[model samples]
Target: MTRSDLNNWLIDLSEINSIYIFSGSEGLWFLISVVAFVWFILAIYRVEKNDHTSIEEELSNPEDLKNLIIEINSDEVDKNNSN
Candidate 1:
């Protein structure tokens, strides 16, 4: 958006007197919260991506996959019983 349009949107979204969002020094808190949320999502995505990549790499060995499946099932059963 143009500078004016961006400014108007920000004003509406984070107005000093608006009841929807905090104002004053809380502006810094709002910015930090947004950054933290984005970081958390990216971290989760990276972890899941790595897990899938590792599993695909390991799947190259058929015997290894069979063993891995047995291990995963055994762990699940153990966890269920423990809980």
Candidate 2:
């Protein structure tokens, strides 16, 4: 067809909902974004489950652990001094 005939056909197609395919592409983008968001949430959940020990609890109970280390170090120093 001539260029003017093709242009006329395109103009006619534009009169109806030209957003039919455009909105289809938009729906696809929304679906992809949703899937990516869900994947990110699941990854965070898994990491939290695997390594979610509380730092506050550990820090709160440090006195006993510190005493144990000090006792061990004293024994080591005594042995070295004796030798």
Q: How accurate is candidate 2 locally (lDDT)?
A: 0.70
Cα lDDT of model 2 by residue, 1-83, tens digit:
33222334446665556433344367789999999999999999988866655644554678966887799999999999999
RMSD in order of candidates = 11.0, 12.6
Candidate 1 yields a Cα-based lDDT of 0.77
Which residue pairs collide in model 1, if any?
none
lDDT of each: 0.77, 0.70
For model 1, the superposed segments whose C-alpha errors exceed 4 Å read 1-23, 70-83
TM-score of each: 0.47, 0.35
Worst 10 residues of 1 by lDDT: 1-10
User: What TM-score number comes out for model 1?
Assistant: 0.47
